[model samples]
Target chain A: GAGVSQSPSNKVTEKGKDVELRCDPISGHTALYWYRQSLGQGLEFLIYFQGNSAPDKSGLPSDRFSAERTGGSVSTLTIQRTQQEDSAVYLCASRAIQGASKAKNIQYFGAGTRLSVL
Target chain B: EDKVVQSPLSLVVHEGDTVTLNCSYEVTNFRSLLWYKQEKKAPTFLFMLTSSGIEKKSGRLSSILDKKELSSILNITATQTGDSAIYLCSQIQGAQKLVFGQGTRLTINP
Candidate 1:
């Protein structure tokens, strides 16, 4: 793939409804990441995947937020019983390298899925 | 415990003006700093600064890192309305994970 791609560019769900967001990373990229951005705010780290293992799950905001990656190629972020605060843009990015110094690598980003909790 | 901070939460300027955005970071094992531009949708990569004092330039945009002060600055000279966007700063930690700043909202009026 030329770049990262995401599905359901825009989603509107009622409060407390469960929502699933998907991310398709670039081809052969072994590292993937998920982030959330609220209105007028910065991107907040949500989770990271190195291959099929997630070593850094500390960024998950709460118990309701969870994510899983399969085959080290695609990932899904699931929000169970979503709240109003979950209304934000969920971004995904991938880098070719699995574990490398940040200065030497660059991550390509997806267009992101905008989730609206009504 | 890593964090990035950007200044001037929002700025409005006319086209053809030069603007400089500031970013400061505090993170252990700091590897690189990245600049991105977000316009209405997804963010586009701008530049990445790893070495201190050496400047990276692309057309009208340039950036430099100051590892001594743990900061960086992005400059856009001869700005255009198309340059209007949210400028984001990210301190890369490892591979795909990055700690981002709140972003500097830049609006250029024509």
Candidate 2:
């Protein structure tokens, strides 16, 4: 695709249900990020993936939140045991992974998936 | 701990008015400061300021970074209704780390 793409622009699930959100980054991008934004709040970084190395999961809120990047192109964010508080727009962004370069860090974002947990 | 703070949690202004938004941060090994405008969904990048005293401009929006003060300001002139949105500021600490501020909600009435 010409730009970053995300699936299921909107999702609704009940508590205790597990949900998966997919992201297809721009071609050749090596860095992918997952962020969550609640109502009237800033983005909460969930995880970061660079190539096939271990993802930086420091920002994930809990164990229920997990993500994986496959083949260095597509990624998926999974949320288990959904709660009402989990309702928010999950955004995905991708950027080139060049070390110490200013242009490398510019992230292009997707439209995001609006997840509603009942 | 790293933190980003934005002032004027919310503001109301009329069209044609000019406004300035503030963002302050405390982060170690600060790589750069980023500005984004968020509306209904994902946020769109606005500016990335890496050096102090250098101003970045895009249309009516301009931003300047102050490395010494650990702050940045976004200025908009002759605002329009379309300019209404949540303006967010984030501090890039290191590889794959961006700490975001709570954001400033700007409402420009037509």
Candidate 3:
């Protein structure tokens, strides 16, 4: 793949409705990241995956927010009982990592999914 | 080493104006720096500067890094309305992830 791909470019859900966002990383990309951006705000890190393993999950905003990556390729971010505050753009990015220092390598981003909870 | 700051949180200018965006990092061990332009949802890559005093350019967009001052600046010449976007800067913190700064919102009026 030439770049990262995200599904459901725009989603509008009722408050308390469950929402699932998907991300498909570039071929052979070992590192994947998820971020959230509210209106007029900077990107906030949510969670990241390294070969299907998330070393840190503290970035998750709350218990309702959870993410999983299977087969180290596609990832899904699930928001349960979504609130109005969850209405924001969810961005996904991926980077090809080989050696140790490559973990901070350049990341290719996908056209983010705008999640709107009303 | 997660501190990254960008100046001029927001700026508005007419077309053909030249603008400079600044970014400073306090990372003890700096490896690489990156600049990105966010138009809509996706942020397109602009430049990556690792060496001090060396300028990286693409079209009318150029950027330079200063290690001693722990800062970097992005210069866009003859800005167009299409150049209206949020410019982001990030520092590579080891091999874990990127430490990004609060982006500078640039708006170019036609």
TM-score (all chains, Cα) for each model? 0.94, 0.94, 0.91
Q: List the residue pairs that clash in candidate 2.
A: none
Candidate 3, residue B54: the lDDT equals: 57
Off by over 4 Å in 3: A99-104, B51-54
Window of ten residues with lowest summed lDDT in model 3 chain B:
B91-100
TM-score of chain A of each: 0.93, 0.94, 0.94
B59 Cα displacement, candidate 3 (Å): 2.0
Cα lDDT of model 1 by residue, B2-99, tens digit? 78999989999999999999999997777778999999767888998876435799999999888889889999999999999999999877544788
Across B1-110, the per-residue lDDT of candidate 3 in tens digits comes to: 47889989999999999999999999777778888889988988888777643579889999988888989999999999999999999887644566788899999999
lDDT score for residue A47 of model 1: 91
Comparing candidate 1 with candidate 2, which one achieves the higher DockQ?
Answer: 2
lDDT of 2 at B25: 89
Misplaced by over 4 Å in model 1 are: A98-104, B94-96
Candidate that would win on TM-score: 2
lDDT of 1 by residue, A1-118 (tens): 8889998899999999999999999898888899999998999888989989999988899999999999889999999998999999999988877456552378778999999998
Each model's lDDT: 0.88, 0.88, 0.87
DockQ ranking, high to low: 2, 1, 3
Between candidates 2 and 3, the lDDT winner:
2
Instruction: Give DockQ per model, in order.
Output: 0.62, 0.69, 0.48
Cα RMSD of all models vs. native, in order, equals 2.0, 1.6, 2.3
